[model samples]
Target: MNGVAVGVFVFFFLLVTIMGFAAARWRRAKALDNLDEWGLGGRGFGTFIAWFLIGGDLYTAYTFIAVPATLYAGSAVGFFAVPYTIVVYPIIFLFLPRLWSVSHRHGYVTPADFVEGRYDSRPLALAVALTGLLATMPYIALQLVGIEVVLQVMGLQAGEDASWFVQHLPLFVAFAVLAAYTYSSGLRAPALIAFVKDILIYVVIIVAVLYLPSKLGGWDSIFTTANDSFNAFNKENADAIAAGDAAPKAMIPPAAAHWAYASLALGSALALFMYPHSVTGVLSTRSRQVIRRNAALLPAYSFLLGLLALLGFVAIAAGIKVENAQQSVPQLFEQEFPPWFAGVAFAAIAIGALVPAAIMSIAAANLWTRNIYRAFINRDATPQQEARQSKLMSLLVKFGALAFVLGLPKQFAINLQLLGGVWILQTLPAIVVGLYTRWFHRWALFAGWAVGMTYGTWTAYGVPLPGDPDSHFGGPLELFPGAETTKVYIGFTAFLLNLLVTVVLSVVLRALKVPEGVDRTRPDDYTADLGDEGVEAEIDPHEPAHA
Candidate 1:
């Protein structure tokens, strides 16, 4: 084991653990017995705090591992993440502030809560809540995967002959710590810890990108080496490439992949904010202006992400090699940096996992307590009861994610995460479109959601790994139906079909005189600010929801 690196990693882990539990007192609320405080940090974070919190929530540990890993593995299209993040901010600027306003005005806690309030349909709201829960599980598992990758690189794993429990003891301990602190501190845990997480990430990435390139000749040398490596791989695998048993490596995508890159970027951009955790971060802000300001400010992370993606090429240039591409960057850090600083990088990745995992668990738990439990099981539940249920459910959610990592194959989590993007994107018509207009019949939106979920999942299931026809969900891109040569993100294709079905069905349902549920929000509610008539300084869970 790398003793210095492991020691440094442990010290930082303990520091964050202390911070996580202590966060409940950082922004001390009058009571922790309400959904508003426990689930959303009292919904009063201003621009600065929201920026770090949302940034920490969205740019996760798996992203740190996976983005660079893709490039290291010679998939040029993997850099779509940089552009995906860029495209998302403008979209967030346009719609999310409106969502923030309405949610604040109506005391909505989850996106599903807003859908139910907007359509007055419990079943549709349940669908949204369940989808959020399902999509979030694999995502939380991916965070564990991130932590696991770092631990492996740190030499924390037991020998190959060790029992499964012995091998994964370190991971289990990390999972326990995450669950305990998140249960105690709720949204505040992640919000407060986000400050440290974002700072460490920036410091590490900036140092890595700036310092490493200079050490390895320069940017020009790095690019040339990476290109040479790809060409060598292609030349060696010429037969496999021709037979479609292996993919050709490229530093830049060829013309045939242009649509693939664009579609992944566009699909991912649309799906990012739809995640329950993203909604949770947005709703935690103080006012609509906070959301808008963060939208403008968050793009800076996109810049960081672009630089971070280059580290994949850097790994190639540095002559780093590993069986798992996810370990390439971590291995690079270990080899290049002194043990002490390498530990800091590992800590950054592990802590990065903690922030998002905490937020996602809390977000998923809120969906359960509000949409499923309060809406169905106990309609008359009190605010304290709701808080208690969410806190307990948060523990269950975290452990459930832990089970996913421990019991299932690692590849399963990664594949489900890909499907998670598509699954979560299916909620867009109901959530994003509902933010603009209520013209969609509630039933039509429900049908569209079902159809989209079904189609996206089925199509993704059929995509084989490059060489293995039997493998499923090998990647997110698929040949666009009716277009032989062009491939697109399955989520985008499914989303279009969803919109088409919703529109056509709405016309038919309207002519059949099917009921459209009453919208509980006023037109003005979507534009209201903190001091406006119905918008409260602190939302009162006891108060009746807006009529």
Candidate 2:
């Protein structure tokens, strides 16, 4: 069972567990009863901590496993993730500082909170709150998938010969630790743990990309082997599909998939920062300037992501064999590197899941507590009650994610992420556009979200997985609606439809003189900093910077 690797993995896992729990004391809150302290790290993380938290959160276990796995399984199309991250940063760079400004000014914790403040509409805010939670469920499942892959590779997964309890125990143990630390420490646990996760990941990827190519001849040999392998694999899939023997899969995107690639990249880029988790990271920072600095600095991760994506080609050069492509990186390391170092790398990948998972669950819980629970269920819930509700909801959210991965097929986890991208993208017009201008009527924006979400979900549910009884929750790409031959990213298609409807409905609703909600934000609120006169007293005044 790879005892040395398991030992090393266990060491790092325990270390992070300790840090997670201790983080409750690290940034010891002014009071533990408030959402600002518990859910958002007192809204005071600076440039350095913010960088690590955002990096560790975005380039997660799923990215570590999926990007390389996609490259290993498919060709250039897998590479779209690199460009997607790149584009997303510039977009966030332009917009997130503004979001930070307004959120901090008004003490808004979630994007839905911002929408509620801007539109003064509880129903509209509720829609966003629900969408964030729905999208996040599958996203959290993807993190578990990351953890599960690492465990399986470490020989911890229960096999056919093992009892069900015996096999699933490792996952439960790891997740239980995650939930406990996250519940106790809230956002601080992930913020503190991100440092270790990012460092280990950078070391592992730098060492692998530089070392693996030489071990397998060189870059030329690696690409040649990868090209040859993918060509053969695609041919096999094509033959099997012709024989009605299998679902079609490919190593590289075909010429026709150009639309698929571009749309997926653009759509994902737009949808990424819209996740409540991403906003949670942004809001946790101290100021608009921190968000701007992060936007400029985050491309370094995109650089790492680009290098990490190349590891797929390395797997081909190494001729690693695996039933699941997600195992290619772990299995490759197992084959080529010493067990101890491989253990460190595997720990980096597996523990990487925890940081993002913690933040995402917390973010989702905040949405539930602030926008749903407190807003609707208990209008007079005190800060302590809100914090308690958020903490409890965080547990439920994490367990829901855990159940998703354990109870369902692995493909369900994968498809759920795809659908997540689409569902979250539907919030762009209502949230991102609202940051710039309040010209779009709130009702029209809500209508657009509903229409986009409905179409995206319906089409996604109808996509066949060839042999499976239920349709594939095939992520971003789908058959271009009403056009059979061409395929496109469903997120982009839905987003466009959403924009059109919003524009049309705005004109119609304006003509009808429909009542628009009052905006509570000021003109200067979009650029307010932590200590600015307009900024709310969210960050504690005397909190020492860990400088």
Tens-place lDDT per residue, model 1, 1-547, is 7999999999999999999999977767657788888899888788999999999999999999999999999996989999999999999999998998999888899999999999989999999999999999999999999999999999999988999899999999999999998888889899988988999999999999989999999999999999999999999999999888998899888888899999999999999999999999999988888888999999999999999999999999999989999999999999999999999999999999999999999999999999999999999999999999999999999889999998987876798899999999989999999999988999999999999999999999998889998998888889976887678999999999999999999999999999997889999989999899878775444543222
Report RMSD (Å) for each prediction in the order shown: 2.2, 2.4
TM-score of 2: 0.96
Residue pairs whose backbone atoms clash in candidate 1: none
Provide the lDDT at 275 for model 2.
94
Summing lDDT over every window of 10 consecutive residues in candidate 2, give the lowest-scoring window.
538-547
TM-score of each: 0.97, 0.96
lDDT of each: 0.92, 0.88
Clashes of each: 0, 4
lDDT, candidate 2, 360-406, per-residue tens: 99999999999999898999988889999999999999899988987
Task: Give the RMSD in angstroms, all C-alphas superposed, for model 1.
Answer: 2.2
